[model samples]
Target: MLTFDIENFPGYPQGIGGPEMMVQLREQAERFGLEVHDKNVEKVDVSNRPFSKSGLKEKNISLRP
Candidate 1:
């Protein structure tokens, strides 16, 4: 939900709309086996190997690719 346009993002040549670009990026991530969460992250811990994520929508999310 960005309120403006993006002018410097790669591969766009001219430019891209913020919301449209966000959707495209999300789709691209999903194609690569990413579990996309459209919720706010409440907590995160990256001191260990397998990272930790905590939030109201979900918890114990793995940051490993």
Candidate 2:
């Protein structure tokens, strides 16, 4: 994804690169307490509340619906 360029992104009138946009988006999301991961999700256990999510680097997680 970082190997390409964006010519007309909304915030950057001139445009932004893929990697730059990724970093910008991450920083913005982290400011609101969101965790970012680059690994593929192997499993998800939503059968119970306050989850026992699997295959992620951060194994301890709580998810609610």
Candidate 3:
């Protein structure tokens, strides 16, 4: 699972933000047969074994066996 903590800190020449970068990265990952989530992550809980992650517009998944 790839979690991106993107922030617009004035590096891009065009009008792009963190969200846009995330989309580009997801597309690249998909080319490599990786499953990309459609919704953006809102919160994450990694304190426990089954690391919990919540999405902004959909149910999240627990990375565990």
> Considering lDDT, which of the candidate structures 1 and 2 is the better prediction for this target?
1
lDDT of 3 by residue, 1-65 (tens): 25344344466555455566777768887898786555678888889979878877677787552
- Candidate with top TM-score is 1
Off by over 4 Å in 2: 45-53, 56-65
What TM-score, over all chains together, does every model reach?
A: 0.76, 0.61, 0.39
User: Model 2: how large is the Cα RMSD against the reference?
Assistant: 3.6
- Which residue pairs in candidate 1 have backbone atoms (N, alpha carbon, C) closer than 3 angstroms, thus clashing? none
Give candidate 1's TM-score: 0.76
Model 1 backbone overlap count: 0
Query: Which is better, 2 or 3, measured by TM-score?
Result: 2
Q: lDDT tens string, model 2, 1-65?
A: 65578997677888778998888888998999887656666677878876655665656555544
lDDT of 3: 0.69
Ranking by TM-score: 1, 2, 3
RMSD of each: 2.1, 3.6, 7.6
lDDT minimum window of 10 residues, candidate 1: 56-65
